[model samples]
Target: MIERFYLKEFLTFKEADLEFHPGLVVFTGPSGSGKSILMRSILASVGLDSVEAQICESSVTWMIDEERYGLQNESLNTFRHVKKEKTRYFINNQSTSKSSMESISSTYLRHLSLKDYSDFDPSAILKIIDERISARSPQYAGILENHRVKFAEFKILSDQLRSIEEKEKHLSELKEFALYEIGKIDAIKPTVGEDEELNLIKKQLSKKEKIETVIAQAQGIFSFESHVSSALGMLEVDSAFFDDAMNELHSIIESSLERMEELEEVSVESVLDRIEQISELKRRYGSVEEALEYRKQKALELESYETMEHSKSDLIKQISAIKAILETSAKELSLKRHAILGETLEKLNGYLGMLYLREATLNLEPCELNASGEDKAVLGLAGTKLDKLSSGEFNRLRLALLALGVESMNGGGGVLMLDEIDANLSGEESMSVAKVLRHLSSRYQIFVISHQPQLTSMGQQHFLIYKDDESRVRELDDAERIDEIARIISGDSVSEEARGFARDLFERARGL
Candidate 1:
């Protein structure tokens, strides 16, 4: 239940704050007095869409233990358009997200009316019955959760299987392409340093003849004896005076002669053999670096292909196992749904009678199991389907569903918001709806927007929404509420007959 609501800079409402209490609370006013606008603001602050107006600031406070009926924690604020495009949400003064606020708020507050009756949807019908029937059983919640999990898993696997099957026709071709590319890289047999080695060999081969010629010229220069012969001839002629110099010069020439002979013995065959080896390497490997890279790639491909078959087999097995589990879970869920059909039908029948339909029947039919469950609800009046019923009849059927929801809720009931739901109802029918709402209020916090005297009179806390000068405001006061109801009855002229009717309705409702 919303303990309080604060609005600022909202449509037709510059600033307004209202406190809500348990039991029926009514908002009454003349048409176009900003009643619906105020309601819309409250809904927007709680994460619902606004009517072409952004919520500048809004806050809602709820009771803590009130979570069982759907209120989990207390106090939520939504601040928007403060300084940027982002909107800020808070729960208990702690900053949160809009999604979180929406999820938590939905637990405690359920906005329902003739325009939106999701509780009456066929998919929700079974869950409602189960919540009531299994209220005392701890195992019931666990069972339902288990069923939900199993159903979710089943859906995921089914989707995956379908996707895989769709792609299966191309699997063989894809595998073949992968294999061919992997094989081509594997046969290259490259090595890391092979490119550098091959390049060095190629260079040597290109300069081989030049290198050999240079070596031969240096050997020939050293082998020549003419310079030594000339130096010996000069020493012999000056032997007496230059004996020491001549002997030293002769020793040097003899040592030079010995080195020249040794150099001439060096083999050219060894150099040619080294060049040939390098040429052979370059031809075979293309380049040493490329060879090494090729080897690494080939190794990786071999490892991948070695395990491909096993991995594919495992995936297939997993898909099959999940399918089996899903089938079993879906079967169990279907059975539970079938079992609850009778109770669901009986409750709808009761509400129909209260709704002024003397001969109404709710029929249950089996449907294929989906995520929400399998039983479908079909309403009939004197054996005719509800779609064939008039608009008024449709609204009444919706009322019946609301009544059923009220009966089924556990512990502290949910907060219900009704927006002119009794608009087309007759005086007696309006009274009946009001009575049901009043009874529901014992376990819930209810806020109603109504023009009907029956509903307005039954409000335990009545708030009148009206325009003052140029602004709209809501105030809680008995005199104001009476005047508002009187206006609704007489249409801007509070005649004696309208006042009397309002007084009588209030008296009768107070007795309830």
Candidate 2:
């Protein structure tokens, strides 16, 4: 509930500070007395309406989710909209965005001044209908739960089936791509380290001739081996060490010749070409190991592509089975919903009867399966759609629809701000509307504007707005309320009979 409201430097009213209580709060005055302006300013303070007030603030009892919104929740949370060159929103003096403020406040406030269609949503309607059905048949809850479980299963299977179909649509291209990638890698059957070996051979061949010439010239030294050994003996050096050294030199020369002979079998062109192929592979795939790994992966993909039809056929069978079960459950639900639709309409019509409006109608039609069910409930008036009704008639119908949910609510529902709900209504019609709102006030903090004496007199708290140099508002006491209601009944020149009538009506409404 809004505990206090303050508005300053607005369209007509300069400054107004008001405290409020829970129940029906009715604002009434002559035309152009800033009644609507005051209401809009209140809504703007909560970020629900756009107004040009310098400072519009509301102190409410709504406990904001402090952790979620990252703001402190005072016992009385203050929502303020300050309009300077631009608009700014704040909660508890902490700066917040307009959207954030609106999000937090909308949970506790519902402005039904427009043709809101939320009441007629199929999910919301179906929920209420199912609740009623469950109350009558306890077994219906399990049945509904079972249907919901199957519906969830059905959705998963249907999505898999759709995915399979999409894949099948491009199956040929996918198969071709897998085959192309595999074949491209297969054409280069290069081995790891083979490139390094070929490059080594190429390096040997690059210097093979120079090394051969050098070795050919160095072989002449073998002829002097014996001469050097004899000289070493004559010089009294050890002949054994000299003979071992010559033998080792001869073995090195022979080994070199043998390795040179082995090079005869190696074709430089084949070695270079192999080197080029391996280089290309390395450039394309980073390494021979990575290329081989890619081939293995594509082989598996190709295998799956070859057997895709089997997978698709199996998925189709599963979907068909699940869908058949869902359809059965849907039909059962449809039957039960049809049974409860009349009860729903009768209750709505009962409320409408009191509001002096035409009866409302509800119809259920078959639709595709969803989480909610397969029912599309349509709510309309007897001869017209809800949108085609006049503002007064539409608003009253909205009230009746809201009344249906009031019974299910456990505690304080929320605040409801409405425009002139009793406008263009007969005295009896006005009183009927007032009575319904008075009942609703028990559940919600209702704020409304009125011009008729019947509705004004029914307010739990009445405030009279009048032009005294500037538009001003004051809460009316018993005598003051009587005079205001009288003015509404008989205009500026209030008759004694109007005063008496207003007093009696106010007392009777309160059961005094």
TM-score of each: 0.64, 0.73
lDDT of 2 by residue, 215-310 (tens): 999999888887988898889998997778878988998998898899988899988888888888888889989888888999998898788788
lDDT of 1: 0.65
Candidate 1 Cα misplacement greater than 4 A, ranges: 9-12, 51-56, 61-120, 136-140, 153-168, 189-340, 357-364, 367-395, 411-415, 439-444, 478-487, 490-501
Put down candidate 1 lDDT per residue, 1-512, tens digits, no spaces. Answer: 66677776655767777777789989877777788887777776666544444443444444433343233453443333221355565555556566655665677787774345464566666666667656655576666677677668767756766655654566666557656654554444334554455455455555656755665565554444556556767776533444565556557656655544544554446445644554454565555455445545755655655665565566678757855665666566557655766776776777777767756565557667565445565555675565576666666666566667667666776677878868888988887788778877888888888888888989999888777654466665666666667777888879988888887777777787
Q: Report the number of the highest-TM-score candidate.
A: 2
**Reference-based lDDT, each prediction:** 0.65, 0.87
- Per-model root-mean-square deviation over C-alphas: 11.3, 7.4
lDDT of residue 14 for candidate 1: 72
Q: Could you give me the TM-score of model 2 versus the true structure?
A: 0.73
Candidate 1 total steric clashes: 13
